[model samples]
Target: MHGLLSAYSPLSKVIRKKGIPYLCSPMPPSTRTPYTGSSRKLVLAFDVGTTYSGISYSILDPGQVPEIKGVTRFPAQEKVGGSSKIPTVIYYDKAGKVRAVGAEALRESLRDTIEDEGWVKAEWFKLHMRPKAITSSNPMDKIPPLPAGKSVVDLFGDFIRYLYSCAKLYITESHANGTQLWSSVERTIDFVLTHPNGWEGGQQQQMRKAAIQAGLVPDTIEGHARIRFVTEGEASLHFCIQSGLTTEALKSGGGVMIVDAGGGTIDLSAYGEGPTKGTFEEIASPQCHLQGSVYVTIRARTFLENYLRESKFVEDVEAMTEYFDKSAKLTFDSNPLFIKFGGARDRDPKLRIRGGQLTLSGTEVAAFFEPSVSCIIRAIKMQCMAAKKPISSLFLVGGFSASEYLFSKLKEELAPLGPNVCRPDSHLNKAVADGAVSFYLDHVVAMRVSRFLYGTKCKVNYDRKRADHVLRFAGVFNDVDGIPCLAGSFDVILPKDVQVSETQEFRKHYIQKAFDRIGLEAATSLIYCYRGALEKPLWWNGSSDFSALCTIKADTSKISRCLKPRLTTWGQTYYEMFFDIVLSFGLTELTAQIAWLEDGVEKRSPAKIVYDVDA
Candidate 1:
């Protein structure tokens, strides 16, 4: 009796509407300083998730404080004025052309259009970019597949293009002189894209490629430079700070934990205030898990299939599950959930179906949420154990946080952990979209923990006294100076779980030997990341723990001009080039450069990061 009787609920109450109100309250005045940039510009943040997406923007005027705003209006939303978020869904016709997108695809009137036009639906497409290391609790086969003849990047291009157009329309219509304001900053606009914490450079490369394809930026170096990446966990922390959710904790000198429970992945991150006021640093390595709200829906679907196997209405399981997802899943409290899917003609009393309604016990519904709940609890404990400082408060924010059941469950289980657990009362789903903008404007996070060991493979001088060196001596070779060396040695520049500052640089020096100057014309250093549990990785050969993370391409032609030929003890002449592979990891993204000395002065050249497309 406490359950709703309709699948198509009011759009405002829909859990997928992870959007802000038409007019968001301005950020607190003291949260940030006035803009100091030389010229006016715009920053647009896109929070593209598996089930829903949103856009937030800030116009930076020199010497004036900036405010973050959301694109409240979107095409096909039920409301006439605006919505906080739009469904991450699209429809493609037989020709592979986009027929409808976002909230438009969910319109009831589009049913006939889809049926007559043979349109294919694509939802939860973002999960396709998930890293191979993170496995989902639910079966991948249950998730919808991409449209025919379309790759994951293609899907991203189409969706990002739609979000861009929506932002344009909303900005122009919502503000004073909106057209003029947009035109002034059109070319120099900066974009920040948020992704899960588990995503690596490979996923970032795919996203950047999609941005170029979507026409958000040109296919040039400068255009690509305008794009930035941030983890959903870090972004949420910024949002929590700006929204004044963490003020009390910060005042008491206690660290905070941010749990971003979204559609596809839940990201966990812990932070402590920096040495300087108004700044923060990561106290623990961030974690991302594939268990999220969508998994609960998947589990529900599987349960329905088996529970109704012997019933005559088994063919209607899909419709029933859809109803349960859109309503019962979000409104579930400690009561029975009644999913209304059909008319009064549908009656199966033996299976607890009457008056077109299907009733499910609260315990059965809780089982669907058990996997996600357990994953979060385990991750939180691990983070607490790994944190350098004690955590005193936990902030829950994201689309999935709307579930009252999930919120109560987390608070109850975490009571004994000594951290206060709570979530924002409103606009919780748009935390990432708004927080992404805050991350760009206010440099709150100063230090971050490295998630893995990053370094380069090099050769080590052979020492017969060492057991490791003796075992690999068979592959030893004589260097230019006739010194015996063994390959496959790992030079760790940065170890896992170490705190690093934003300005910190990790440099690894190496000397390359070539027979001629032409061999030193160009240099390509392949950077590798170790995923194994070894405290100190010494070798990479014959081990599956190592993988190519990225390649840093540098022009060593300048070094060739400074080097001269040197004769080995065996009377062989060779050129020796000295250089250093410099890497920066504290920022949201990784950057690298090559450095060497020219005439007693250090010269540095920017290195291009290239990731394997298949990775």
Candidate 2:
């Protein structure tokens, strides 16, 4: 790995000397264009949380402010809890068919007593996709095997398909009626999926494939329903900032740590004000872990089942759980949660009933909440430690952020550290979904900090001055003329935490030796990447830190007719093909172009990132 200075310094001078054409041109100009979709354009913002999901949309040009409609138009409408979101639970039958989804699944479970009916109900399935989420710190950390004979991705595809269908139906029906919509009548519906900030390209690919299968995104050259992904932390930040929910953190350059505590994972990202107002830049690499509000529910459920199965008010455990979630979870009080049951105090003296209300011991309530509370605090501490300056505000928003107990505890612990804790009063329920619509409109984040070290695999010559002599024996090498050429080296092109802007580009040249470059066939380029801050990680075969981030290929059919193969002085014969790898990083996703810039007419080849499975 290069030193801190080398990681952040200008790369043109150093890389140019290595025969790599690093694009060091200054960032280009910018512009914003309003939606051009016909008389009315529909944008769908979908948030698939761990325990809940929400959908919201904006019209092309609906007055001065766009009306963000909730998902009350969908099935199980009454179970939406007066918002766009619904439970992320699904029920399946033994024949691998979906029995019910969302609130319907819960309703059916109690209506038929499915707990003993041999029916398979899956909940909190989102926890399985998070990388390294299962741990022993909490009792509910484990993700057991699925009983539905389907992968996590398969289940998620079904859910996403359902959401897309609802959005399509709404848009089609609204326009069918002679409605005077915002845009011209010749536009298409665009879809945006909001996910946790910690997800990598692998998860993104899984989601893309699923969306394609769901018919939301057409698999065609002129792709219909252009798809976009917005991270939950960034989306929540946009929601708060756009709604004027951020006050103290908006000051000049005060740092604000945004904690998105959803149902499954809690993600943290610190941001500082950009050059002007209403703009921001990432100040630290994001952090995430699977400690969410669902764990609290798990703790309470276990205690209830063990101690109160005989209570009359808790005859239906499903109803009892729902009551605890909707009525008691958000109410803030030092007193223990008490449910009103019939006057039966003499049946069990241990079940304390004050005025006929069964008292859930305060100790029980604290025990269920302490683990999640501690995890959230630790996550905030990590972001503060990573930030360049003290975090002046802790912006808390998400479904879990609605908890008064969680909010009060975080305020008490974080106030002393630096910033004031803020929980938006109105949008806490659907902030991620709503903010994603804002993200699609404004594209609030102009700059982002790369979380992983982006690089490639290459070889370097062994030298007595800097190269270790053990490399001669341990590392793979080829004898070039008498000197050893060390192979299997990690060449870092972009270091982690470096702020990458949209205008900047990085270009490198690659020449293959003796691989029959002129075969007039296919070509491939393997782009290696790692997550840690290791300066120069060796491309060891079995190291988990290093993996192929993406595989891109180039075309040589038009390899300049004048180009010739080179015969080395080392008595080795090889075919040399020279082409530059162009990288553009100005958008939300990293993209590359394998092309030749000749006479200002760029000739492009096939260069798509390849994904792999590894959890």
Candidate 3:
């Protein structure tokens, strides 16, 4: 499953419902924070891949092109022309204090383990953030336990803080070594974090929370980064369309399916080129799956461990890991290939390797790659077959997208289906980050397919005029003529896969039912966003794909509405208050507003989105 739909969602807490920054949205601010001095502007993009992460940027100017820098400067690591990708590793002490991050963490933790120390490496900790539920029996239980007292969110925050600090320094300090060379003066950095497209509001919300906690946003300190998000697929699409990289069919307004195969998730979205360059119309709702390159590595590691059981090679984890990192994960061949790790004295006559390297055969490696690769192939095939229009192109992008073996496998299977498959000639691995910068320049997708059925739960009146026994006895939140009227009934605001524009809005009026002594507060709105491909999920009970995200609350106390006891048409006396709930859609996040209208004047009251943390 695509592991992102957080915000009172049923997925993991790492990603939950995304709340758009009220300050940045076009909507009037309910409350305003004091402004500090403005700083210089720069656009930064971060691709925080599960296996590895990267950073890229462009100036805020319209004429500039984005650049992906080689980020090789971590504490205690020498610059080897800097690498575009950094291992997403973090090391913490016995007390759960973070010690190192990225390449440094990977390099030091192995050293410490060899010497038997307190430093424990949380390798692939990103897996803990999966948006899907898992039991103790799941393989995720095998991921290295984080040190005592630190939650996954805490660690991810620390990692982001470290990365953000480093990136800020690098952007400001580096010069003359192929760096973009910005002024040393303090500058406002705008970030576009890329994630799998299939993720929902909750996942995005968690990212925003992490960023703020990481001090990348407002955290007591006068931070310069203004953060936002773009999905990995969207960023890749931006680069593809702008660089003239899509197949001819896609370039000329034909359909293209983007498969962003990254280290953690494979995100899919189908689109047709728009009349305008770099613009597209979504053909279907995006899809995401946990199948990614890390699965291949995991399979390979398990195979090696079992194959070398109790051997000296197995005992020396460092050597084995180095071999896997350098050799096993890179090669892809039909003819057998060998991964040789042991020294001359420990040589095995494995024909797959040349010049006496301890090795694993190509057959073993293929097995490792098959699970993820096969799943991806099936997904692409399904997407193409199900497309409303013929998919005339397939543009593969992401770190895994750069793999020769993956490319070859995709071509062999997908080429026969008749759409041209292509990739960027350069910067293949950094497209997501670079494209995120492009997305900041302008949104490329004209519209999006709604991934969920979003709406509210309101009370519906029972029909006394045509009362049935079922209606008379049914459970209800309110009653009329002694007939039960349900209040938990779902109301669809936006149906799934329907077009949503940057300027589109969903506004509805609801009445605040009587509570204790004349209500002093304005009415608050609760929005329920349900998953599933239902075009009309209006009446869906608590059957499936349903979750009550945190309530969208607006302070109506300022509007001065005196709750008057009034008689209803059904001869019921009640104190009723009326207010409106509004949701404005943006390219990535939704801006919400709750208002009280009086005498043709609208009061923009303070609004807050309370997330469903327990869900």
Candidate 4:
């Protein structure tokens, strides 16, 4: 509940004093190496965005470098001329069956049938799966409700299956001996799914489950291991590298920041060159903002609703908004724009409607884009300040970055800051998809920064002298050892914004005292993610900012044999066992393991991670 600035002051000063040597230290080369596996394998990357989605894949042949390719051709989109993405739209019939998807949902021929059949159209359903922390800061009224009888996971599963089909067809038709090539590696293909930077372990778990439901992988441990995750920010970084967008900045030794301005979230991440060649290390914790291209359309809708409230065409506002989004939103600049809302007979001079066309002033259009532009600027400034080194270049790439006004505003406002802003000449919408492939192949990022304080709640020895401890008298309880203890004590395993290497493991030892030997046969650690501003929180205290992230449970029947029974001062028998909860956060998803020493030798067991049931 305290000010965050106070906690960051000391760390900021230390970072400034030490120059963050960890960020720039020498690291082992993660440069793109030839595939060394025994046989041929395929790696597919899917960017299932809120408004659009794309697929990128690589065929890994032993001793040969993998090549990344996009699924350029999709059903109902053959005439689009090598389009790298398709609309993230779906229509469901009354029986909860998928009637249409992607580009097929937009076909003009199905319009009448869709309306007459009462099929529900779903768009921006990905936003429903976004972390609660993000939805709390953004308005949810603009987000449409999911179709009846369909969960967000079902939506994801359906879309993923569609994209998977597209990938299969593209690979089969585009390559030489295409049919044989696909059939050869169909059983063990690996998948890399990209998500916004704000998504965490719980979101990743849900996505994994959806993938299983879609049959991209099986519902088993090995099948789960085949799917990997990468954030949009980091994936964009890899895409920039593959496109040769950051060559000069990497050579200059200054940090580089990637602003992935997509449909639903604008993700920002900063990175610096490692001491070794072709190695990158995160210099600051990544950030994701809800202000994106879709929000601009929402703002425009809000404006039209108010402006047309007194007119007879108020019922037509939704149609007009959709038309504007498709026709004028992306191409609008400092020019008068017109939106066709009705026929020639629907003329109204007062409302600037003539011949069915509704005219919009350039200023009014600019107002709709102002909030998203400002959000990007503020996020960029925050990243620059938080980065360990000076950020010299900013790479802007995403579906939203294609907007001239958004890009122009960002370049103009950021010019004074000295970082050169650049957007690749290649397809901006394909960044995340392509970058995810690069992430799987190049593996250049050697380290990452933790975004939250991850820890577990445990009982701590009670201190009667502390005022905070006395305030929670009702929650205090005596352990089996007859010692006063307070539950809900936070034991932090990793602090926010700290640099962690790929192989880094954080461990916190804990002891459990039980009355009988049966209780020591197994143990479960409830991990909680703290989002509050406090630097070192002492207790959970039922704070709103704390959520149970996951539970790590392991069988301790073997380790329990090492414990010894003892008697407390009150003549009660008790048994105690000690173990460490180990966590790794450097990868895209968090992993947990339990470790305990047995007979002077260390033994480890894989602990099953169970996320919040309601998540």
Alpha-carbon lDDT of model 1: 0.85
Score every model by TM-score.
Answer: 0.94, 0.82, 0.82, 0.92
> Candidate 1 clashing pairs?
19-84, 19-85, 20-84
TM-score of 4: 0.92
Cα displacement (Å) at residue 236, model 4: 0.4
Q: Write the per-residue lDDT of candidate 1 for residues 7-49, one digit (tens) a residue.
A: 1111111122233111123344453557778898889999999
Q: What is the lDDT of residue 76 in candidate 2?
A: 61
Q: Residues 93-151, candidate 2, lDDT per residue (tens digit)?
A: 77777777776676633656565566687877876666542233665665545655787
- Number of clashes in model 1? 3
Q: Which ten residues in a row have the lowest lDDT in candidate 2?
A: 1-10
Root-mean-square deviation of Cα positions for candidate 1 versus the true structure, in angstroms? 6.8
- Candidate 4 local lDDT, residue 451: 86
In candidate 1, which residue ranges exceed 4 Å CA deviation?
1-27, 137-141
Best by TM-score: 1
The positional error of residue 75 in candidate 2, measured at the CA in angstroms, is 2.2
On the 0 to 100 scale, the lDDT of residue 441 in model 1 is 80
Q: Which tens-of-lDDT digit does each residue in 543-598 have in candidate 3?
A: 55777755787666655354556666666765556777878654677667877667
